[model samples]
Target: MSGSTHTVTNQPPPLVGYDVFAADRVLTEGLERHLDPGPLAETRAELTVLGRAAGSAQAREWGRLANVQPPGLRTHDPSGHRIDEVDFHPAWHRLVGKAVSAGLTAAWARPAGHLRRAAAFLVWSQVEAGHLCPVSMTHAAVPALRADPGLAALWEPRLTSTVYDFGLRPASQKAGVLLGTAMTEKQGGSDVHALTTRAEALAEDGTYTLTGHKWFCSAPMSDGFLVLAQADAGPTCFLVPRVHEDGRRNPFAIQRLKDTLGNRSNASGEVEFDGTWARRVGDEGRGVRTLAGTVAAARLDCVLGSAALMRQAVAQAVHHCTYREAFGARLVDQPLMRTVLADLAVESEAATVLALRLAAACDGAADGDERERAFLRLAVPAAKYWVTKRCTPLVAEALECLGGNGYVEESVLPRLLREAPLNSLWAGPGNVQALDVLRAVQREPGAFDAFLLEVGKARGADHRLDAAVRGLLGELGDLDAVEARARRLVERIALVLQGSLLVRYAPAEVADAFCAARLGGDGGAAFGTLPHTLGLAGIVERARPVE
Candidate 1:
């Protein structure tokens, strides 16, 4: 028999071998409440399959291995010729292949595509997030490419393909392809229009040769990139490919790979394009306008990514507490522990509800619903700002729930904690998002009206929500100092939206707990600070993952 000291006791079983999709009451319920998206049976079935893979022990191991052995940069071939490449572990390829084959990138032309794709992305990201950088770039590239008919005609089918074409090849030869985006340079981070990379027009047919340095290029291994560069007319967008049609290397030189804190499995490179052949994406001086759709889609992905991390962290915490024992009782049964879990659960549900609502709006907007498009103008950035900002703290609290065990590298919480801030930092940091919302509120009155109309549907549902709406309106009535208070206003806007969503869609207990704790001023600053009067155990139980 194993010795008592060596035996493992008082440990929670691994949270694996479960249907991540089916177990998520909030996600499933919100899915239905939002759009009744494309035949529920079919959509649910497909997501369930992906969910099973995400929750499997095998998939979890893939996540671990991929992170442990991050991708490597190859700047030159053995001889002397420059052949910049990024080499990823087998697990990375598998994860990317799984996501791509499941139609994660084919969301543009299908029924209820955005909602379904967003749901799938939310689930798979819990497994491994780094590889999704390329996946997201490829998916978002569809709209930017569509700005040019010839470019769209050539690249659209390849981008939306379910096949995971994993190597550099001519676009015409590949069954599928991946893409990247490079808007930020060393001198200009979010100031994309201040680019110095020059693009010289070669012929009238959208061809150009770009020459300058690109400070941050996402997914360097991608076959092509939608980059920003200065043209004769001003700043403009260009499509730069890794391999030309005649099988000649483009003059794109990889300066170095970025040493990021997390998301190490994906390669972020600083590249130099010297007389590099590219095709103009849109007319000069319109790079930002051409990239509008791409940026919006990316911001929405950040929301989903943040929400997915929160759900996984909460699931892990609840699963741990459900089995842990202290003071002669199950940890989850303890009053204080239950309160914390419930609080975390409430926050997670709010994020998921808001994210799903946004995805449904994407579907609507795709179907030519002008109202949904306008709503996205304001909601996407506000949600991105608040939800992503909340992820780091929520993950940290979830880790604390596991006590000393959580601090160790063996636990997934450490990895999750490292991954937490990435969404907030990426796709324009919190300030950028808040300021973008402020600009929208100033220039796009229709967007604000649409947002008000959406929130108005839940006007009489909850007193807290109603009061919140009133407070927001009063605050927005004056813009004399709005620039200085943009973040505060945006946070309130996101909270009210979440509150409205819960009031109309979530379970009574969840909505009540959320309104009471978040909007009703009954909670503290940290997780687990919800009022003790609520049904704590029931709320935690609803969020627990099955094994």
Candidate 2:
């Protein structure tokens, strides 16, 4: 692998979190809904290209896992077993590839599906391994790992599946595994300080030898890992390969895999790493920082996943409404059905728009500096909390729309409903996420305020976007202080997206539609009313730009 650098400039802004107006703009721009016609169409075509080879089988395997009793109830001795020896059924692999492919294809055709395939694909990928492992950590550490010029050669061919040792590069075909870091330990679930994993530097080898037991590794069967261990300086991240290139070797012994309620496919495993060889990623003692970055990305991924799942539920409900007859009329024909569908539509739209806005924010990043990181940090918990928490009720409501069929296995609603809760639980449950949001604000009091100020300034400068942003900022200033202000931050997310979409992409008509929808015009409820009101009042008062 040769080292070649390409720089991206004029990127989109970092996404803060979810909002209704933001979603409207995306749909108007056709990002959510494609303009192309044909079997695969445009969005579908793009999704297909991005689809993992292991999608279909993964879904079926996931369904099976969902149907089975959780691993928590199953009798298994982790002390006697190793994660790798557990073979992934061959049929499961085939099913995964097909499902992922089909899911991706369907996502493009239906804006409502969006990231559903990716969510299910990821779910099954974890299940394929039969245990939960911290798989998202790799995404954060890979940049540093790949940056090591010395390791590039070894890393290149391993990244993608397309690079057939025969000839093609992995990029030519999509091939990547989830990577993660287990920050929590037996003592605490969210407190990193309680982490007991220790990394001792080996004087002779110039490498750290890691020894510790991790409480929860969420994808125990993942291809690679990012392990956090306490070094002399502090906690640090070490890139540890779980499976070797030859596809043999599992040094970490499994203590046990947690039987989770929703994310059952991947067993959440307790792992004991005994003298695992680990290369330091990023600086030592900055594991927290590295972990933070990783968490940010993972949070975004979670938000995307949540939004996609919500979209899936809503789409299924909408489909059912169109076909399932009620009182001699289509379910959609009923006023109540319309209300339910509208609520789902609006909420789903809000979640998706905020997700896309986050993508846009990262895109606009000149470099992944403190500001970008800050945006992600604040946004992660908010997005995850909002989307996942919303996912359960939204899905349930969607199921309600389906009535009896919603409860049945044959109906996808039941599966979706079951899977939805995991979105909240898997990523530091909603309450944990809320606490993360508060912590982020405390750490960087100006982070969110800066974002709103930037949007406000941009709007003031652009005549076309002025009214919308001004209206948003005014609402921000009117919120109650402290907790109430914090609440408003949620709504401001929608407003920020509104400004972002108007400036970055969407047309005037679409932007207007978004603002109207969010502001509660045209029979729409206030999209980000509570949060926007709360966060804006709290932060805006502390640091208001001189007019």
Candidate 3:
């Protein structure tokens, strides 16, 4: 049948062919300010390439395919041999391989690595979030393995390699390998200390066998896992390889794979360890301490992950409004709509600046900067808590901008909305991060001081920031109901830090809008509540992604 000639008009063009890195003014500016000139130039060029690729038709199709056809878990072979393997679509492999080749896992081994990897992670995650599970685990496992020099020597090189080798094989045989972790048990999720999984000493050579079930084992198909189990000493950290030294499959039984709300491309499984052979990662009694570095790295990724989601959501919203006309004018130019978009822009930029600052802190600490180490100890938990919490609402609001289109699966916003809450829930819940912030202040006062010092750098730059900092210090001084008020306290701390960064680095219009809305209390409880006096148009324009 001949098609009817109906004109398609007024709809915004699909948001493709734009450069992800070049479009993000906040991210690009943050990189220039934070990274060394040489690394900045190199990373800028590399990310420009990645940005184009991430925005390409191929990458978008891969994202859709991976999510639509999530991974499947196969527990037995044809003859019923217990073969716990997860089968992912080719798109998943392609996305993950691209990430590995981009050095998302090799950050620790290169110069200015953390900053570059963090930026790349933010860029790539916009394409798809599920693949980041294994990517993040592989990157985080390096620091935890370093507790055992022998393990580090054996695993670090392969973990840092850019090749993506997928299979249950001996690490010795793979060109590269990925790592996962199983810390929380069924009975105790965040309270890992309540874990009941027991480890038996098989020999005096620091080898052991783990017998228990892990409630959440992310990246189940990774070559190895860093697991926590109760030992003779106490809860201990262990390295459980998928394959034994003699090349036999270890007794790692996959109970089931979780049916999650989002991040569908990744497989999170329930695994039972039936005499799983393992090597202790650190001292027998210091499991939590040994995993500190790993946890910190993962938490940083969590913040980056959330920030990436917010950035992409806002970009999509702005791009839609720029083209889609409503009520005889562009939606972006409407007064109330402009306010909403600008408010969202302010939030996205703040998150980007703060996340990059944390990455810069990681780079500094790696360089042995004592003050940065202290600052990071406090900043990570605070930023993780605030940023992840902010992501859900930001994505939801950005979704509202698209009206019905945003709610549908075809637009990608719905996936982003689903993926937004995972980061906050993954690393730890809000209370966990809040308690961590309190613990940092109580246990390491110096870290708290360093955080204050860092934020104080913009003390006189903006009176609103100065006043907010002063008020926060006053609140910190009064620790009454600290636990009860931990979330509020952490939120204030995050806002102040974000405000300080904006004051120092961002444009005056952006900084003023953020300060007025967030710090000065000129905004109400919801998005688009910024005072009409602020430069809303400028903020929105700055946030708009261009080709």
Candidate 4:
């Protein structure tokens, strides 16, 4: 009985067996605010189911196993037959299959599809992020393929199908399909115009043969790839299937799988395409324009993915603090710890609200609202720039709240921290997003007007936000050194937009703290620097995951 040395006392229980979607007040609130009444009920019911499943111990184990047992590259069969396949753990398939069946990739077909899928994505991604790569790519590819109706008709239904059909086969043979992208070359990066990959016309049926090496081919195990290559006219988009309609393997080789810092459950490969068969998606020389929808949709996913990580990090931090004790007091009850948790909660809330707002804009655009389309031209990049940038630091700070325990892989905070920067770098780097915002403001008059109208609605509702908006306007007015000052200007634009949303929808305590800390600059550089009189405890409690 005296051998009790190993008994733990102050440790918190594992944060599982709770509704991930329903527990997130901010995410649920965003759903209510964005979705119509009829759809809101059904969406909530569906998401609640996913949330519960995501929160289960079984699902958590699946996520852990998927990451630990990262996918492997199987370049050949036992007889040395060329079979470029990436071998994933069964857990990986389960996570991805659940996502696919939950309608994550079927968003393009439903009413308020973007909002519904964004909410589902944010919640399920909390379970595992890696599998969502194909999920997101399949979702984004819908619009890009639509540029060619024949291609859309051929692939759209499979890509959006709820059945998670996994394997290399002809698109015609699959009930569901995942799409990957091989656009960035070794030298070009985001500058697709600099790509040297050449595509030669093969037949009059819009078929081409591509020969190039893609530096980063995301979700390599996908059924097909939306590749960008130089055609006779110029750079154009093409769809390259993994196999021919007759079950013959395409000339696609997965050279090597990227050893990424995190999201190891997913396979990103350096692929080679020598005489790769492809069908052109749109007019040659207008590849960038044709794939603009894909880029934008992916950018939005960057924000949503980052928000999911941030939210999960904060939830873990707050949940830890609620139980772990030091010096005869729970960490959540300590003044400074509560302040830190509140600061993190505020950040998570702002990100959730802003991300859903962007999703709502997409929904509007789908409903034929040109104004929302214009608004997205500016808002998506700006939010993508700032929110994803904040995710890394916020997650790192959240991990710190657990002290040494958070540093270990068992806590999941380390995983969250590692996954944090992936979103920022995925669609394009921060600089690209900032410059995109600049381009939108300069070229699209309606975009800037739409942005201003968005922020202007909350004018005088919160003085600090108003001042920040004015400051943003003045910064926009001055074009001197604008290119050099793009990051600064974009940060202003993003913060003002977040402030506007918080002022309108967030609780008084949350909005006030956000305006004071982010807009009015009444706080210092650290998370615990918010003014002492704010409702820090209440904010922390709000973010606590219900179990």
RMSD of each: 1.4, 13.7, 0.9, 1.1
Give the Cα error of residue 491 in candidate 2, in Å: 5.7
Give all TM-scores, in the order shown. 0.98, 0.68, 0.99, 0.99
Model 1 C-alpha lDDT per residue in residues 1-547, reported as the tens digit of each score: 8556676789988889998898888888766766555567788899899999999999999899988999888888899789998899999999999999988899996898999899999899999888899999999988889999999999999999999988887889999999998778888888876688888889667889988898889998999999999887888888999999998988888888999898877889999988999999988878888889999999999999999999999999999999999989999998998998999999999999999999999999998999999999999999999999999999999999999988987779999999999999888999999999998898999999999999999989899889988999999999888999999999999999999988888888999999998888888888888888877778899999873
Question: In model 1, where do residues sit more than 4 Å from their true spots?
Answer: 1-4, 35-38
| lDDT of residue 335 for candidate 2 | 57
In candidate 2, which residue ranges exceed 4 Å CA deviation? Answer: 1-44, 48-84, 89-92, 95-141, 144-153, 160-178, 204-206, 243-250, 366-377, 431-446, 453-547
lDDT of 1 at 363: 91
TM-score of 2: 0.68
Worst 10 residues of 1 by lDDT: 30-39
Could you tell which candidate, 1 or 2, scores higher by TM-score? 1
Report lDDT (CA) for all predictions.
0.90, 0.52, 0.93, 0.93
Estimate, for each residue in 265-324, the C-alpha lDDT of model 3 and write its tens digit: 999999999888999999998999999999999999999999999999999999999998
What is the C-alpha RMSD, rounded to one decimal, of candidate 1? 1.4
For candidate 3, what is the TM-score?
Answer: 0.99
Model 4 deviation from native, Cα RMSD in Å: 1.1
Q: Clashing residue pairs in candidate 4, if any?
A: none
Candidate 4 stretches greater than 4 Å from native = none
Q: In candidate 4, where is summed lDDT lowest over 10 consecutive residues?
A: 1-10
Worst 10 residues of 2 by lDDT: 538-547
Model 2, residue 138: distance off in Å is: 5.0
